[model samples]
Target: MHNILSVSELSKTYDSRFQALKRINLDIRRGEIFALLGPNGAGKTTLISIICGIVKASEGSVRVDGHDIVADYRAARAMIGLVPQELTTDAFESVWATVSFSRGLFGKPANPAYIEKILRELSLWNKKDSKIITLSGGMKRRLLIAKALSHEPEILFLDEPTAGVDVNLRRDMWQLVRSLQATGVTIILTTHYIDEAEEMADRIGVISKGEIILVDEKAELMRKLGKKQMTLQLQTTLERIPPALAAYQLELASDGNELIYTFDAQGERTGIVALLKELNDADIVFKDLHTTQSSLEDIFVSLVKEEK
Candidate 1:
């Protein structure tokens, strides 16, 4: 896995103030679905805009597939496609016409067969002749995808790709993204939907306040940042934890009917055996025990809040 896109010391300033982005450095591996997660005003879009050449960075540089975005603007941009959050399509244009023109914009030769393939793949072939305005919200989003793929770009940037779509459509979009990845097309997406990143990303990156907070394999990040909890249902209610069990640092919950123990998920030793033995010596009886691991959403929310 080699990097397909790289941003180094990329900084953006608006009107000499309002630094939308700081000295951000990131590399997106080829053929991986990388999800950029952040809160609003977190500079997710600003970073994407710089990579896609929609906005110029006031400082630093970006490279797309080894070509400098500034020096090789045309060659670099030719390999990328962007599906923005807004539905900024011509209302009167037919689906076929709109998609066809997008490919032409890239200086690619006309290929109706390719256009038809993408349309059918998106379930938009039948609506090819329909006006953009007549299509439903789901259809319009799907149409936007079709247009983005029209030029057969190697790298696709999906900015809030499933914003207002229905559940079924979102499912379809995920399937479609996988299908594209199978073709060796690298995808970089910015999504407010935490589940979308949890469900689709191979690697996840967290950006907060114009800086890159963390980037790691989705599973690794979860394992490293996530906590594991064990809940013990006591046979009898207690007013408070025993003073001798203070070393365990357990919290009494459920009105003292239960106790919660938390530990690192990635730790080699959970100390459960010792804790249980101590509970027995402390005359603490448990009715049952269960454990749970933290989720990506929990980790994400915590990170953003910590940054703030």
Candidate 2:
């Protein structure tokens, strides 16, 4: 549970007086997958850039593994690797050369074994001699990850890693992420795909209007804020709801052939028994009933909307 990275009172303001981040304070735990979720213009990129030493914070400080990003820039930057949102790479460079070169940029001595290991792990071994431009989009994306891992960084930042990838590739990337975690790499990702975060992260952080809003364990966050809905397929279609069922605030759907009741998942009582009893008294029988809980995307949308 030790912190591998820390940001304190971080803020960013551009020349036009646009404050990109507002007193943001965050701690990334060692060997944990932390997902940072936010709407566009919410400082997700700005914060990552600052941590990667690409952009300077207007005020405050960041430390990577006890090394201040500003004062001990080399050490701080060396421990972190960033896979940016955009696919920026030399089109003419071979996969092996590009990855090897990235490690050298960090002043890491040439470790061909390490480079080969990462390329193989990323499924880029077959394409090691392929020019960057010759690889498919998915292969290029994997190459970015290979380059990031070339220097054996303890922390990896994946910014919108699967943004435009197909479903199959996304799942492949998910598997890759889990394997990386098994190797004890701390992962901090900023993604627009909420399901990606829900599936991969140990904890979730929400930022809005350039400020950190909420951070919680994924399951706990969903449990606290998630709601459940029960949909009953009625045996008989009804024109309207009965007066006695007013308390349930149910919605008639499927042209009155279905009744949808939403209830708080965290409530002391869900009132299901009472609802069934009332349905029996009203002579309303349901053919079937199914319940669904809130999804991470639902909670994310609500949080962002609340901020707006």
Candidate 3:
């Protein structure tokens, strides 16, 4: 995993009063889907804006493909494609024309074949001649992606790419992202959809209050923070946890129909065997039993709350 983008002690303060981003340090690996997760106003957008030259950083530095973002603006900006959260585009311009214009903005020569390929890849070929204002919300989102990729950038930044899209469109966008990754394009996306990150990201970074709280491989993060719960359908209703099973820290359901035992999924011993043995000793019987693994959403919420 090569570091294609590097941020060292990056800080952004407005009017020397509001710190939008704390001293943030990050390394975005080449050819990987890195998901940035944060709550609203957590500086996710601010960080991406600085990297894409949309916003100026108050202090520190950012390097895109070993080129300083500010000192080597052309080279750095050329290697990155930013799909902003806002859907601001020339309403009268056709999809094909708009995307082609974006390529020209990067000082790249016109390449009709490349533009055609990008349009087809995003399923925008049929709508290529259609005015931007006439396209559906989903098509507009796809057009944004096409515009970003027009210049053939090495890194693609998707800022809430699927934010307002329908479920089918969102799934299509995920498939499109996967296709882009297959072509060796590194992707860094900031999304409110935790499940989307869990499904698409190779690595996950959690940011809170402008500071990065954790960064880990998606699977590794799940293993480290994920928990498992053993749910027991009790044969008889109980008002509270039995005194005999106090050591296990069992939880009694509100309806008194289930007993829940939670433990770390990565633990050497889950203590289920001991817990069941104790239940047997106490002559407590269960009608049914089931186990469930914690989701990435659970881990994300827990991490953010802990940071707060």
Candidate 4:
């Protein structure tokens, strides 16, 4: 569980008026998939840019494997691979040539075997001879990944890697990320897809207004913040909740045909049994009852709203 990256009191401001990041502190563990979730203009990409040395921080410091990103730019940059949200590549260059050029940029000795492995893993081997402009959108995205991985970085930064891709391609990207993790590579990704974060991340961080609101283990975050709702279809119309059942915090539906009970999902006892018994005592009967669990999207929205 070694820390592969650390950021202390990181802040960023542009044009001396707009602050893009705010006092962010984080530690990314080795071989872990950490997902950063936020709305557009929430600084997810700004934070990534600063960490990758694409943008300078207004204050504080960052270290990649103990190498200062600012002071040891070469070593720090060399240890990281970035797949940006935008798809920009040499249009006329062959896929293989472009990826090889990327490795060369890092001053790494030519390793054809490693390059071949990366292309095959990304399903770009067949198109290695094809020009970048000739490939399909999905193939171009895969080529972006192959190029990022060309240098054999210990950490990979994926900024909306699956954005604009089809479902099958997105799934393939997820599998590729898993395979990369198997090789002991640490991954940090910024994504708009909450389900993707829920499915792939070991830990999740929510950011808003250039500030990190919460960071926690994905399951623990869900359990701590998640809420459950029970909807009961009343057999008869009720104008309002009974005074006796008010303690359960029940909400009467507008149509007067349902009662909704909201409660914490992580509670040791949901008190549903007691509520049901009390309902029976009050002569309140329901025709049907259904329950639903809160999703990651729900928790994320709640967190961001609270920050505002």
For each candidate, the alpha-carbon lDDT, in order, equals 0.93, 0.93, 0.94, 0.93
- lDDT string for model 4 (129-224, tens) is 999989999998888888889999999999999998999999999999999999999999999999999999999999999998899999999889
Report the lDDT tens digits of candidate 1 across residue range 1-308: 79999999999999998999999999999999999999999999999998889999999999988899999999999999899997797899999999999999999999999999999999999999999999999999998888889999999999999998888989999999999999999999999889999999999999999999999999999889998889999999999999987877889995999999888864526578888888899898999999998889999999999997
Q: State the local distance difference test value for candidate 1.
A: 0.93
TM-score of candidate 3 against the unseen true structure? 0.96
**Cα RMSD, model 4:** 1.3
List runs of model 2 lying over 4 Å from the truth. 281-283
Clashes in candidate 2: how many? 0
Please, what is the TM-score per model? 0.97, 0.94, 0.96, 0.96
Clash number by candidate, in order: 0, 0, 0, 0
Over 4 Å off in model 3, which ranges? 268-270
Candidate 4 regions exceeding 4 Å error are 268-270
Maximum-TM-score candidate: 1
Candidate 2 residue-wise lDDT, 239-283, digit = tens: 999999999999999599999988876552658878988999999
Report lDDT (Cα) of residue 245, candidate 1: 78
RMSD of each: 1.1, 1.8, 1.4, 1.3
Q: Rank the candidates by TM-score, best first.
A: 1, 4, 3, 2
Q: Between which residue pairs do clashes occur in model 3?
A: none
Error of 4 at 204 (Å): 0.5
